[model samples]
Target: MDEEDSQIQKTQLAMTVPTTRVDVLVIGAGQAGLATGYRLAQEGVSFLIVDENQQIGDSWRKRYDSLTLFTPRSLNALPGKVLDGDPDGYPSRDEFADYLANYALHYNLPVQTNFRIASLDIEAEALFWAEGADGSAILARAVVVATGGFQVPVIPEIAGTFSPQVRQLTPETYKGPADVEHGPVVVVGDGASGRDIAFELSAFKSVILSRGRNRRLLPEKLFGISMWKWLKVLGLLRAGPNSPLGRAMRKSDPFPSRERSDRDLEKRGVVLASRLIGANGKRAVFADGSTLDVGAVIWCVGYHDDFTWLMIKAAKDQTGSIVVKDGRSPVPGLFFIGRPWQRNRASALVTGSTADAQRLVDDVEQYLSSTRQGEGSIALVAK
Candidate 1:
């Protein structure tokens, strides 16, 4: 087609896309999004929650099969619903997923599943636009990005060097040992995920745990009381980021297992190795210059914050993490929720969502009030 004809067709197609308008637009329907939505509802604000997945809690459901929460049911509840089960017992991944789904249903939150946001931009002062993967869009007075901190899986550069016959998978894709070939498996990373998977795989195959640093273990219970209960008594979980206890907690890793130490794992027939450095054909190389012959590799390297689709310059930091001060962005009407240390270390957990959402919704309400009163503007000049 001629250039003039193509231009006209593109213009027509763009005009055909539908646009929605709301007071607030939430970009995810996960625990963070639902928490924010519940608070928004309480404030009598018009809002909607949109998710990329077809189901409300499919994100958790898609995790590796044997996954379970480290936090007990009592501390895993979100907003208005308490997990109805053994208070001291951790819930399986599937059970948590079901709880999230039920939480949305119980609250009757307005959620549009399978609606992935493609781009977010400011159309004008106090006016924001969120374009979806589909042709639809939402124009809002305020935007809450509740997509959580875990957006992209992180695999190291050396993973590509493995032989084609050797299977390599990330925790997000690894279901169980049955998915691995009938041979030894090397699990990389020393985080909770790596240790958990290694523990499960040790029963069937020779498992190697390759890690950089040893984690400090916390007893699941102290004097017959759960560790979470002790943290509550100490007020550590609720401490502000600048507080002394909060600072120390943030510097430390999440509490590890009291029952499983390196020695314990070794006793269980799980070999502990140094950090994985690279791979040579079928051989897995470690930072200690040692090599392990394995049939499969599992990378539990964790995730990164991804906001590439967000077109606002004031929305993200140099590392692509969302920038917010007490949940409010520099741009007047834009906010971020479910970010690690967003307000406190608990900000990313289900138990912490209620407090985080409460504070953030208050900010959103104040921003909306100021904009309505002609106190300030939301126009953010691109940096």
Candidate 2:
């Protein structure tokens, strides 16, 4: 998922603030946001793309340095831009970040970076008002929250019970073995990230991967063909979440690691421990009642859905995730993209955003037109 942290204190100011008017306002200039912007530009919409990061693709760069996408370059490209490299080879996090930067530049898209939106609301005037910390605001007819669901790092509540001396790290903060302290490292959550971290740290520290359940390790290739190619040809990627085939996939969304497994980690000297249940001082207790000493712990437990910034109370569900059909939320003129299974299985992948963006922009266009809104215009209003 395209990830970043934009959960901050909401700036409760009036729409009277020096506001920038736009036809469509897209937040988070990540893959999903950029794709949405591209589609909006193609439709001749007066839109703006804003991101909290200093650059267009810092979201990918801010991730772990060892991060390499599971999808090859062939499947990772955004719409109209081919990722330049060995089509079958995976791109490192840095390489993908640079590609996103170049994609924005080549398209000459209007992107505003280092612009953090603290709060958003839809007023009775039929305009979306977004306030920033620096006293700037955006008033738009429609808002596309392209930021994915992965906004806040989610750790178990049991973490607070651990001793203060045990240093903790999330994938957001963890870079490499250098970040780990002396002694064994206990990695919580045996997902792809957890496995990758444990496998990498095994060479330096006595690494333990807490496996929640047995993960299926499909080979990277089948019949001498890349598994992705197989998936595409099998029509698995086109299945929507509501489809019979897609409903089956919703059971487990993580793309099973093709390379790493308990056997692979065991051979790499990684201890395959049971699910982590508790932690006390320097020892991490597992579900099997086994405890192992640890110096540092990494939580690859995943992220929380944080949309508290969107001040539309009725539009949010009990879980705080926006209630949306496809990308359109319960409220008119407010839409979301980049959510897994939002439209289909590929919705989680970067390339998947292209189709979703196109459709969502179409919906946005329809919403704007049906509302009898005039063409986008700019004006200098009194602050």
Candidate 3:
């Protein structure tokens, strides 16, 4: 090889070295984790962000190639950087990843790629440990679990007698229409992913599925007002559970536009079914007392929150969500951002986490200062 080409390869090898320890540790290098890192960097605090992916943007890049954000580009951006594409259009999956990578580089955030956090343990002090691709263990102080809701895919257990001829796949494992074997496809679940997948696949084959009958779809805009604008104006999106709008939102699915209408799917030759009861080879039973034969089944059922690796017993509820009251958790030094109804309507959105991150930053400063002053010390410890 030429000398210049050999030197370039050597420089690439120099960048992959890993290190341990930081003042703060953020896990899951997706939107939330990266945002937290950016804010911490701005504050000049020593911190490190890590992810399980071998390369940056692996999370977004692994999704189906045709996937696009439901939210407009204007609403989806990392801290300090706006998406470079059309502001009016929903960005493709790759474009979103490009934005994130740019955000990390612009801030010069110290992110250790390919490092996967294995577990967190807290005794008198918090201990964070992770396993890297090279089989090295890295440790840190404060830990922010930004793993988000998409890690685990939940597939329901249905009684069955299958001939082993029918194939099944989850949205996580789905790559494209080319991945499925030839024949009719049955997609289970009526959530956003299910509908989008079914719609995309309907063009190629006759599809069938089940759904909630009374589900409502909210237009991104009503009249000339963006739905986001209305949510903010009507005070519906950010209202607390005690507030009328917040109460209504909590009871309603946020992305109602995702589910296809019965007539809409029927126009595409997709059959809407009630439920899956049991299976017999290619034939399946439904809750409405129906049977059908299909070549493939795609289960798009929602996920369950699993925090078994985290030792924060007091912070989580039975469902593994951090219980918040007035934007504060029960555990000290523990704050949750990007969770449903954590603060305002934007709590769960990519852009909305900035507010939550700022609040948590302020809280962290106050906590450290108070501890240094010996005011927050337990009375029993004095003995």
Candidate 4:
């Protein structure tokens, strides 16, 4: 049989299985999903958390190998779990991933991995049918979309102009310096990922960091205390995106530490390049009319919010981002957690998921209560 026909047969075979029904389905088994699940457990709510990966916390594992969060172990944690070891010390990618797995095991949250929510739609009142990639489906009453941000990587279309000799990669694919090609490397976008990647690569390769937005860099420490402590004390991280402080934060970037400053980057031999404008062959064209030929290009251009799998159009705005106000969507049974600026600047960070989760769980319970009142069906979270 042809490949297409074989795939069709497989999907048909998958559809033969009965759809599992639940009161709440929290999508994405990463830190966000686990945190939300913990809250549901506290409320004794019937819920299930599902992820596309074979294991929980695989999302963090997918990042570059040398990655270490600026947020310390103590600050970034789920509702009930404490990331062990020194509270002030940063946790490496692997360490955090293991913690997530252990958190699920400790709490025994109802988590099902490798269950990809391919698409979702609401047919009956308050009901969501989340179809799996395998053609299987789940029925739920209320959905907590704790998938977190960073859904789809953003690569400029101009990258196609580069010749085959130049290797291109994204954060999802590039693991370490070994993944990069020989010769100079041009890292695009100046976000946290781009900055870290450039700094790490500078030790081994000639790296040029393509600067983007000019973010305000805060000192790692204020007085003798850590900057994180100050943010939490003054409620800076907790500020909403629409709040006066949140609006100010949106205009400015809170750099983790001063060591990552441009001066330090220059000291470490990381060339600060202008905005990336175009590319052809091995030439990386910059906005400053300067160009460089590099062996490989790492696009750290952040991500676009992808709700394509979520077939609903009621809440999504023109930019495809869900129209969420304080983590609750306009859709009755749909809610979100782990959204950047959902409540404030902290909402996107691993440290921030629990805050959103608490509110979202309460929203879910309220939604389900209404469903019960109306004898309505359940909804599903499409990650």
Candidate 5:
């Protein structure tokens, strides 16, 4: 077509994709984002939650099929809805995902699914702009980045040394032992993910789990009461970072084992090895100078925060985590929710999102009010 015809088509396409405007823009629709949206809606705030997933709770649905929440149904409930089943029973990953979807629908949360935010920047003195992957955009007075801290999978540098014949996978991508070759499997890292994977794989094939410092194990039930109930009774779950209990809990790793111990894993045919150091040819080397011949390796190390899309470098810290006090970022109008230890030790948990969102929404409303009152521009300084 001629240049004018092409220009007319471009203009029409642009016109069809309208820019959304709101008082606040939430960048995720997970537990954290939905919690904040619920609070914002209750306060009559005009806000929108934008998620990259095609449907609500797709994030949870993407996890391994056998994954079940460590937290029982009672504590796993979102802000308004309790998971509709035996409160004491654990819910599978798919069940939890469905619960999240139902929660969003029950609350009528304003969420735009399949809209991944590509970049965030200050559009003007008092407004922020969020551009989506689909060419749509949002302008708002405040922004809450509710994307949880764990956005990127973290595999160690040694992973590259493995032989091409050996299959490699991260916990995020691993579905089951069927995804690997028929030979032995080596699971790297001693975290909950590694333990769980090793436990499951042992039933099908010979499994070796690379060990680190062992984490404290809490029994699934004590005296016929769930261990979560004990944590709640001891005030450990709700303790703030400044509290003595919180300080102790933060220094400790997550309780990895529920009802199983090292002995139990050994009894189940899971051999515990020293830390995985590197790969030597086709063999997996360990810190103890030993090696294991394996057909596959699964890295359950952990995840890192992915915030490179954010235009403002001043909003992040040296470690790349968003610099925030209590969900309020160093940038005045910018906020972060669903961050680990953002306010309390429980800040990252599903049950903790409500309290974290409540405090964040309070600060967000205050910031909006100040902007409306012609206050000076928010000081966006890195802490």
Candidate 6:
């Protein structure tokens, strides 16, 4: 938090004008967006990354301060640089943001902070165009949709109601216990975020609402090798959502267990209640036939995908990810990178995304070469 660093954060925070275009346009400047842009720069591709937020890593920065990534530092790096500070330690929320900003500056990635993409429309000639924040637009011969999966929060619809005095917020907006006004807090959702938040607020009085047992937390390592290493060996990491690993995870009725344990939550007296039935004023009813009075409720239920802003109609499954027919898209010149299992088990990981980016460069090179050939043919016809 030096003076210079502080100033840089401030400059990026200002949400000014928001419109422009470039040869290639990337939406969302999180880990995926920045990684894609950095790789594109190396291949001499004239591209720009635009984010709705005012700065890089805004998504990660907005999370609760106590948050540290589940994965270690070595697994959380981008192309060309490793995360600073502790190479093996899980970075703090802000440290991760700093790492992202540095990654952008290090490579001089052409990222336009605060340039929120309003809508992407296709003009004539099959050009992919995106309308920027102001009203201007960028048209590219190709587009990479790296919006990622963690933008929206999914709040469940429960019965009953709480009084106005009860405070409720999602983990997306939960800063810390200090952010709460006062009193005991009841957190819902047994996912990682739920467990973490419950642990954080336990000292101030807290309870965790477990909807149903899904995944139990396991350490990253079993013996000497990391669990990810074992997963890689078993080919579980490379398995697509249609693969056996993916099918088992998707079909598991309760939920897939977590990779890490919630011992902190359990030790802090965080009650593991069943699904919430309803709320009556200050009392919350649980499926276990129990009731408790809570001063606050925090939901950590995860997110959904919304690609309404993307105008191109490509072949997408129910999840909105472009279906890869042998690592190629139905739309020629349109490519996808940093997607889950786009390549190997590492495709979605930060380090793995770079590998995906390199693969994307191959597609980019072919597309540009084809574009030049098309233009030459048109010139010959005019002659």
How does model 5 fare in lDDT? 0.81
- Which consecutive 10 residues in model 6 have the weakest lDDT in total? 374-383
Query: Pairs clashing in candidate 5?
Result: none
Q: Per-residue lDDT for 1-383 in model 5, tens only?
A: 85467446544544566677788889999989999999998988888898999999999888777888878888888777778898888889899888888888999888889998888876545577677887777777899999997788798888889888888898889998789775689988877678888888888999998887656777778898888878878777788887787777776655636645677789999998998988965799889999877898988888998888897777987777667787777787999999888887678888788888898899998989978786443332211
**RMSD (Å) per prediction:** 5.0, 5.2, 9.8, 4.9, 6.1, 9.2
TM-score for each model:
0.91, 0.92, 0.82, 0.91, 0.91, 0.81
lDDT (Cα, tens digit) per residue for candidate 3, span 95-194: 8888788788888888778776554544234433333556444444455667665667776676246446777878778888987775678788877678
**Candidate 1, which segments miss by more than 4 Å at Cα?**
1-15, 241-244, 318-321, 374-383
Runs off by more than 4 Å, candidate 5: 1-17, 242-244, 318-320, 374-383
lDDT of each residue in 180-230, candidate 2, tens digit only = 877688898887788888888988999888877555565678787778777
Model 4 lDDT tens row, 21-137: 789888888888898999888988778888999988888899899888888878877887788888888899999999999999999998989988898766455567788887677
Q: How far in Å is the alpha carbon of 18 misplaced in model 3? A: 8.6
- Once fitted onto the true fold, the runs of candidate 6 whose alpha carbons sit more than 4 angstroms away are 1-21, 224-226, 229-235, 249-263, 313-330, 339-347, 374-383
Better of 4 and 6 by TM-score: 4
Better of 1 and 4 by TM-score: 4
- Minimal lDDT window, size 10, model 1: 374-383
Which portions of model 3 miss their true places by more than 4 Å? 1-19, 123-139, 159-163, 256-259, 312-331, 372-383
Better of 2 and 3 by lDDT: 2
For residue 335, what is the lDDT in candidate 2? Answer: 90
**Global lDDT scores for all candidate models:** 0.83, 0.82, 0.68, 0.83, 0.81, 0.68
